[model samples]
Target chain A: MTGGAVADNPGRLYVNDKKAPESLRDLRKIEEALQGNLGRAREATVGIELGEGGAGSGVIVSEDGLVLTAAHVSGGVGDDLVIITADGERHDAISLGLVASTDAAMVRIKEGGPFPFVEIDADDTARLGDWVFSLGHSGGYDDARGVVVRLGRIVRVADVTIQSDCKLIGGDSGGPLFDMNGRLIGIHSRVGASLEQNMHVPIREFHRNWDKMLASEFIGEGPFAKKPEPAKAYLGVAAEAREEGGVEVTRVLEDTAAAEAGLETGDVILEIDGEEIEDMENFLEVLKGMEPGDKIELTVLRDGEDKTIEVELGER
Target chain B: MEKTRQSKSSWASARGLLTAAALGAMASVSPAQQLEGPYRLNGSAVLQAFEPLREVLQSSSAVLLDDWKSFAYGLVVSPDGYVLTKASELADRDEMAISIGASKFTDVEVLATDVEWDVALLKVDAENLTPVVWKDGEEVTIGSWVVSNGSTSRSRRRARVGIISANAREIKGSSNVVLGIVLKTEKDQIVVEDVKEDTGAAEAGLQSGDVIVEAEGKKMEKREDLLDLLGDKEPGDILKVRVDRDGEEMDFEVELMERHRVFDGPQSRNDAMSGRFSGRRENFPRVIQHDIMLSERSVGGPLLDLEGRCVGMNIARANRSETFAIPAAEVQAVLERLLEDSR
Candidate 1:
């Protein structure tokens, strides 16, 4: 963030400083507001144990044990997990729906109700420079360490993410980010290398997908999505850059397109469908756009002669 | 991996852009937008507004330096030129001095030190210094607004604002203390796999085939039983260990050491991201955990509440989110003991 020129306060506080306190009195007011709601917030924050191995954090949003967490932490729909509450009681839970694009996911506890929960920011009024605090079982939950809290300000706000100065790490993902009023404004996502570059799934995204997530349906697509990625087109040959400007096939696996097309291990692939393939990287890029089972012509250099061969791409 | 690396580089470039934009914002004086957020908190206008208040509270603050570079900070605890600071930060420093405004005091004496609290009492030649005003027994609850100081350069400091992030409690060496022995289950017995060289186990003459029988008067039934015993122990703690070496009961007094010192393993990702931390971070008797981003060197100063009352002394920069401070009541007790020892 750029440090703007210090201008006069013109007898009125800027909209940005609405939450960031400027004076001792205002600071005291924020302290009072935060202290009043801190207990409830702590009670809702929970530790999540991934079935595969690692751990993360989440926040209870409903009394029936609806938890809001990062999509990456929730993994896939119906994935079983153990949720440890503030009092150190563990409950069985299953992953619900998730919007992978926003890194937002929901989990429902299998046991019956009356769980501690915090309210999401209903007004969606969180903005830049707003004072916010986050709670998580950082570095995993320990009965001795308990829940850790961090206070910061929203440094940058994006469409689906809000960047805060609050420092978060591996186990802090899926934790709740709250305003001074103890309203959940975001869910902790991934963290950047810089301490101030922590990303959070904005509360609005959860609000938008509230219905879909409740129905236990996984939605959206991205790297974090539970949906399977499309298969990449395979050429079935381990190739390297030749000294003479073409990709030299080091090895050709059997039962593949290259072996079926009579492309030997020593064949130098010069072009793919008339486009010059300079090296191994270039060959991979051309194949990336094409789907599995696509037929293409390969310009190959066998011995001292250039030959054309038609090959069908295979699934990787 | 590629995406996260790209984002990191982008953040670095964005920081470069921020510097350029900041210069541009300053160069053009056409009623630009008023600064807000962290920069505003760091900027002069807001800092200047709190200058008078901070000046009075920070009068007792002292920055210790070596070769004109700040290494640690301290607070004037008495009118007789006594300054208290984090003890471990001054370890192995031959040339130590504190810069008071424009004056540099090179003849600083290490009057006394408290190993448990990691605090030291130093005496300078000067007298009639403004001792910090401590609010004894004041309730510093979580979410309370707190302030600290960061040293930018020699004798130059900035005000840092944050809140009490966690309840004040005793932080034992839950993660740092270690026996320095690799163990494995051999036929349902917790057998020593390997004893690392120069560790407490090796120092106690523990061999590879020795089976741990007892630790600290407790019988070890499994590997976790020994681990559980070590979890409560701290560095420099003496553990009375008894081992069965080929049906021979051999007893040894072992002194435990820090985990990182014994085994130089990879740091936790969070700790690696948290720039620098105090060498002696854990095992405080009682500490007020706050979210103020003070550097490791900037610790040892006073932590003040919004009312300009000194609540505690900053002791350790634990990680990116947590900075531990010795609470006022505890600081008072340690200060008394140190002063008593100094005499």
Candidate 2:
């Protein structure tokens, strides 16, 4: 895809500059820093393309080029792949593993690093209706240049992160979620009806499973000082304990539903059907409810480990 | 075998013809015309199959990542209602919907497909009647005129003509007799004179698969349009074959062999290992699996042989496109025993 920066519009982001009160100028500084950091963030964010499977959205969560995204965007992929970075640079990355229940994965870039990075704020309290921000990449190496920030309202205080009037798009999956203080709030998850409905995984969830995500290329930088609630099922979808540590993708069956969905062999699974998956038992039990040909999303850790990706649901 | 000489030397002529077709209609007096009048074709057929076929297809439905501007071949035979098509068509499924070519969308359920034979089955959600009839292993004679039906873009079907060049020839891969077809016109023709191994007009003392130099008696410009001319044919039908084999050009009175498929379900390299064979865990430390190419669509479908007899159900695709088919013959035996007990 041709890579470049897309201009900002109120409909696209949560914190509209015009809406930022003068008193919150310091907060706006974070946004400016984000824009500056994001320009360089190209090194961190990678554009993913799985042949036959549409291109997916991914972010550099680690300095080493470890990107993060929903697993459904990259898991169980069978098509050829091409990875592109900001500044229009293109590289190749492979998927590691996929936890069927949680639509998440891990991808790895083959070469070059030292990319612009986003630091996750382990202690920021994400309040309801806080103006959150998002940065995403898409087609053409130049297209992955801009960011989208939408006000994420804490709509549901339950097990799910249901925010109202928040928007994400086909190219926004797996991007970062930022708080008003410009701290990382969550990872962009998925889109629903209209631009107002969107889903995201709390950035804190990464801290919950830091060990697993750190198993590969990640050197933990987060000072996560809090613990999330214990796991439980939500809406018939199994919600397990936050991963003690994230899992790296070891194998992905080629041409299966997973492979066809564009999942490679090294992607790491992060979430499933909106539920967070932690271990093998939790993962397997979640899968029992779904039959073959079920489509879901997955978040994974790719090469250079910190990047996240979002893959569309395909066959298992 | 005969068209090679004509096409290799008649490239310009074919282009001229295609350009003309693209500009408007392909032709009328195209000797390959077999149908009576203008048959009205409606919207695409992607539904209408067994309940299971529908269930699987509905779940497995996906859209091609990119929309293809042209029409592709799709057929239905029902491996108990699951339709079969070429694997290349279903290789990359985006979501559960297929992009409509020429502004139309066809929601296709790709049940099973194989890379080797490039065959796959998809279940569409609509229903019944008017399925294309098959000519069950009909023996085709040499030198007969035939017709072909195909579409270059989605939604439109066209017909062409050619001839039968060869029949029942060995091509190496086990299974069926692969035949060859050829075509030749007046001034231009393309094709190779002859060769060995690969089936087509060559085995029939005709060296085809070559470029046609002259065709339809038109001025021989270069080779290429020959295949298009020849493809306009049907099995058991024959016409003149001007093939170019091994850089040589020749014209053969070739007979066209009809295409027949061995209703195979999903199959992997394990054709020899059809049934579930498990050994005692104590006897073997672990079960060794030979992963071969299989297709996801093969699930819940039947595998057939050259004789059209059902062999097994395609279970999985491994190592890319390799498939594994579970023998229906074995499943039938189990069913017999179960029925016997009920009696």
Candidate 3:
């Protein structure tokens, strides 16, 4: 992360060059701009360990030890965590809160310090094709390796997320994404369909919800947590809605209530609990109101014969 | 205690829960433009930044085309239309064609193919082709700007720029050779468990329960030790194996084949797409890893420096964060061998 510093000429957009560097000096200037911010940002970026789970990357955003990370990495508000800095120093930290919808989270070092931090560019002025650098503990913490830096372009910028061509992997989540000026622009969110398709949470969103995060106001469930759904009675049969007004069982999951009830593929479900099952949607709607262990009589059509079978539902 | 720990990370309020209906509705909503302008450029600024490199590449790079599809990109290595490209893409084609700009030549001949390095040399019946000049031993320090240029599927020139993330190093791949011998631990020594019939081990006179002492002069104390010795050896490679049979040490030459070739419908395509999309394959070897965003098809083209000098040839689009390229020196060495083979 050590490199020579370049002169900071404010108001000069680093990406104004519409062509490749014309000379070695131009190339040196480009290198210097990346190095200057990268050297400082690497120190501010830390590795977050969530006990038994895998590690993630985070950036110290405030001098008083406020750290920003992906909500998925933080897990939940008040979660005890350990943060490892670039120098491999471990610090105790607690998750403050998360904006689950946007996958943004904040944490604070329990032991306060004038920590090295990167300023978040509140304007979020990152445009398409602007040069950006990403630093993270890619492939987790390799003691032999220092903070990894990847230079790429802002592939896309939107209201909710900024997509970049920068390659990110599992351990890179919650890492800092900085513009060419070395300002924090986004937080690494998730990898898209391809390596070039990476998503980041715009720093502007983080600034907008700064107070709520500091107040420990938790938003939706953390990234890894499945959103809580209403308990549904599980017949455990893969079915398709037949055009002729019934749910056709395509496959029955083994060891499930449907399998135990002698449900087989090709069996058309006509009704449940004396309620006519019009289609797959209706069948699902009826089950939503029921719970596991609920006994219901199912009318099924098999080989041109209609038979009612008693079935005990399982929890899903 | 486990339940309490699990609950700590769970949502405390039901209001935040997303019902199945709600989840379905969210999916139905059009995903906010993940990309704008051309899907490839991501933005107009990217187009502008790449214009210069794209202009240089369009003149010096060619599209390797088959009868039906554009398979790969080729870098003009010589003035008289000698091109270099990835061998795998050109391996199974019925015919080879080279496309420079809008002009297409069908009378292209495969000069040589180096399977070990996954590069192919081709000679096109053309003249006045712009050859790319090498930077020549240019040390690509980490964080230096690098640009990858190649022919897109639309036959248009494209370029992606990034920094050198790592120096050149050997990145190992998983598709290794199979000696066809199962080794077992016996009395702190690696013993031959079973040598399948018609395999290199059986052909080399290896028998069940034979204690393996060394392979290719590397002493084997355990099963892992023998595996390490055979890790780098490929199929058809002659291995000088020494084994102890009934207190008698005997050396025998054994040939190695790929492990999966012993059985199976098809050897797993250890191709980049298998790894790039699934993120499950092993890494390549001896590559200069960079952050340039080039697709698998775009590989085999030249990675140019800011001064339009060929720094390397894009070899593998490793993953989301790293692309591998064969350095100029290595590419030059391969091109030399290819020329010799063609002669």
Candidate 4:
């Protein structure tokens, strides 16, 4: 901002048909509102600690310094984290706990201070083509960054994910997507590697997991609750997803299962436990429920090459 | 060998005291005080620091320089009167002359230079020249107090103190590599941030990442070190110094380079308005007997500007918000013999 003066080129619209002047003005109002909201949201990123989490973004949701950021940030368990502001003032923070299924975590600052919080819609019904903006971190190492807003229409609303046209990158994950009226509909999560695609976890998932979190000692389930029954059909190898591209084979653990069935890096796993995987989410959820000693057949696309191996799981 | 060894050891001790005093002085300043003036360099310092460099910066035959004196940012390397400046500063000018004491006699000759770091050495006709002083391991660490000696009326020197937030980053827009310490004191510290390679700094084994804590036993926390050293010097000279490396004291000899004029030809007239932004003077740091001195002289001469500051030295600026200075550690090599006899 030039001396805090908002750039005069605001209130842009992206609708399909011709609209009335009043409607045109309304869209402008929405854009500026989102910008203001975005500016406020970025305050968290700047003051967040560094190396605290492997990677994730979040927002404040309570008055007592409780913030809702990605579980991945807290999950890293042993990194030093600090957040900085746009003007570069830094603050140290600690992670409380996380609810993995919905990708949300609760954090609190040691000291109390005023913070910004976004309101969530209770009924869970935001129409398609509605004005939605994702305020997320972007660019190098993605810390102390401001929100890069990519406005788009909502296409699909599922039990867990909300698909949208807004273009997002790695740093956008765990952030929020809001309705122009200031209601939180979903989070700004992952985006497809090839297309201008982006996805998010609807606010309902967060709400659904709220009880489970309150009842349990921590939010998310403990490691490897059960190796899915369908996992037996494919090779049992651990994998992590990439933001710009396809799933990568991070570890083979022990090939006893996959070695009897072979797999390697750059190998794309299409199915796990026989629950055909569409992308990163399908695979992650499958592993979250896997049991030790589970024997599974693996299918892989290694390099331009394709192969498979059956292997039993081992203790981490 | 015994004499040289004893001199070196004494130089080392003096450098150590300078470093300690600087840190102590810096620690006493209040945080609120740092947010305001004294900590904030008056705009004149930026101009004064470059006065010397403007001479050599306008020379450099390796690049084409049209009417060298027209460019900004050259520093004086020798008292016989040699000018040293960045190669890019003279990229367009092929022919240049050294102007001693701003004298009408302008035909000084270009001498040996290191093209890699944009440092060109020149020689002018002058006698009994004065130089900036520097000691081994004498650096202006990240948070040291500094004065930008600029050409201004009423206020001759502008000072700012900052911490050395980062070092070893590459300079933008030029192939020239800078390896020296940086000073951090305020919000607007991003204008320049390095000392050139193989110059007085790089030669004294001062690597880019070393943080300078003091100079000449004058605590960096206080503003006395540099001010006290500048009291003695002609335009085309070098400064010796002491630097703090990884908490250890060391010695270096940095030559004071000159600032050059940026526009001097027909094409320059079209863009003359922008050249005015660089101003008229600046400071270049150099090492002394056991201290670091920051000097700015015009056309490589000792004539002080209207504000009582040495003019025409170039200070390296890094960003829209920060700047750093180069100390003269090697340019004083010619005077090293003089110091040896004096001691």
In the range B36-109, model 1's lDDT, one tens digit per residue, is 54343344444544554577545678888877788888888877678999987886687888866555799999
iRMSD in angstroms, per model: 9.7, 30.7, 8.8, 26.8
Each prediction's DockQ? 0.09, 0.00, 0.09, 0.01
What DockQ would candidate 1 receive versus the native complex?
Answer: 0.09
Q: Which window of 10 residues has the lowest lDDT sum in candidate 2 chain B?
A: B279-288
Candidate 2 lDDT by residue in tens digits, B126-181: 44322323323433222122222222334333322111211222112221222343
lDDT of 1 by residue, A74-161 (tens): 8776567899998999998877678876678988776655898998777686766666788987757666556777777676666676
In model 1, what are the clashing residue pairs, if there are any? none
lDDT tens string, model 2, A104-194? 4455554466666666666635544444545554221233112323333333222223233333444445556664445556655544433
lDDT for each residue of candidate 3 in B1-343, tens digit (9 for 90 to 100): 2112222221211212223243333334435443444423233444464566677788788887777467678889887889998765664578767788667888888878765677889888888878998887656666777877643655577666777775477655544566777667867888778887777878889898888888778887777776777665655789898888999999999888655345331222112212432121123446677776666566778888777888888877755566778888888999999999999
State the lDDT of candidate 3 residue by residue for A1-316, as single tens digits. Answer: 1111113334334433332334446545767788777778988988887755467789998776789988878877656788888878889887765888778888877664678999777665566556678988764554434677887667666676777777776667788999877789899876644556667888987987775566444666544333434454677776655667777887777788988989988999999888998754466568768888999999999998999889999875
Measured by TM-score, the strongest candidate is 1
Shift of residue B122 alpha carbon in model 2, Å: 54
Model 4 misplaced stretches (Cα beyond 4 Å):
A1-29, A43-47, A50-55, A76-92, A140-145, A214-316, B1-343
Candidate 1 whole-model C-alpha lDDT, 0 to 1:
0.74
Docking class of 1: incorrect
TM-score of each: 0.69, 0.30, 0.63, 0.32
